[model samples]
Target: MSLVKAGQLDYLNELFSRYSKRIYNYFLKSTLERAESDDLTQELFIRVMKYRNSYKEGHSVQFWIFQIARNMIKDHFRKMKIHKDQFNLVEVIPEREDVGDDELFEREKKLHRAMKELSDEKRELLVLSKFQGMKYEQIAKMRDTTVSNIKVQVHRTIKELKEAYFQLEEV
Candidate 1:
């Protein structure tokens, strides 16, 4: 990143190689639209280049990149005049080897539905903390909140998810 910041355009390739899949996966998880996620991932790298000079010191590059990705998604939604709740119906479930198990598959589908029903903020937190495997401290820094606050929010979010999941089970 420093190399790219220093105007070495070739170094951008290195950054792309390192981050493209991760960024794409982030979009894929959030959007669940393969083509849209691909486009967003490409656009994110373009924005990084366009805003290369704005990259500051002492911040995690991953966090900075993700913040930009978040902004891009928000802008996209705004431009389309779509409410997040209507569009956020897709959630990615990890593929299981036992694909023949009807019960497990049904449960996974229910969980995905419950995840989609969560508020966008809670879903984003879960994506960053759980799926992305980022630490609470890192998420707090990215979100401009205290670690304790992030922890509390994550706990509450999990509880809500559990309740939602159970309600689905009952139905």
Candidate 2:
């Protein structure tokens, strides 16, 4: 990061090589669209280079990069003018290796539906924290909030998700 910020253009390639997969996976999880994810991932690195001068010392590069990613996703949705209802919500469902297990497949489907019922904010929080395995502190840094606030939000979001899941189960 420092190297990139210092006008070392070569460092951008190294950084891209190291973080491209992680960034692509994050977008893939969020959008569930491979082509869009790939495009956004490439755009992110471009923005990284374009705005390299904005990089500051003492900041976590992971958080900084993902903050850009989150913004890019928001921009994508805004440009597409797609409502949450129009999103491919089922794409969030993980593919099952045991495709023959009807029960498990049904459960996964139900979970995906329940997750789609969540507010975008709550859903993104869960995706970053639970799915991406980011620490609360790191998430807080990305959001410019305190860790305790993030923890509370994560707890509340999980509780709401469980309620949604059970409601779907009952149906």
Candidate 3:
């Protein structure tokens, strides 16, 4: 990133190659739209270049990139006037479970449905922590909150997810 920030345009390739797919997956999970995710991913890199001067030295590059991604997602939802309850979290189960394929698929479906029931804020937190594999400390800094607060919120969110999951089972 410093290399890119130093007006060496060629180094942008390294940054793109390193972060593109992970950032793209973040967009995909947040928006749940493949085409939009692609467009957003491309746009994000453009912004990074356009705002390369804003990159602070000695900071985590990953954090800076995700801060941009998070802002873009907020802008997207803002422009669309998207309601919190309307978003759907499509997949929640891991692949390659020891359980039979049919059983795994069923579990995935139920979890997916339960995830959709989460508010957008809760869903985004879960996606960042669980799906994107971002550490709680990173998420805390990203959200401008304390790590303990993020952990408590995550714990409550998990509890909510489990409750929702079991309710689906009873249905």
Give the top-scoring candidate (lDDT).
Answer: 3
Candidate 2 per-residue lDDT, tens place, 1-171, comes to: 998898889988899888897788777666655677879999999999999888789887877899999999878767545664554543545567644587988887776678777766677788899878999988897888999999999999999989999998677
Clashing pairs in 1: none
lDDT of each: 0.80, 0.81, 0.84
Q: After superposition, how far is residue 65 of candidate 3 from its true place, in Å?
A: 0.0
Kindly report which residue stretches of model 1 are placed more than 4 angstroms away from their true locations once superposed. 76-88, 94-108
Which candidate comes out best when scored by TM-score?
3
Per-residue lDDT value at 29 in model 2? 64
Please identify model 3 stretches exceeding 4 Å from their true place.
82-106
lDDT of 1 by residue, 112-162 (tens): 788777765677678778878889988888778999999999999999999
Which window of 10 residues has the lowest lDDT sum in candidate 2?
84-93
Q: Provide C-alpha RMSD values for all models, in order.
A: 3.3, 3.5, 3.5
| Better candidate number, 2 or 3, judged by lDDT | 3
Candidate 3: how many backbone clashes?
Answer: 0
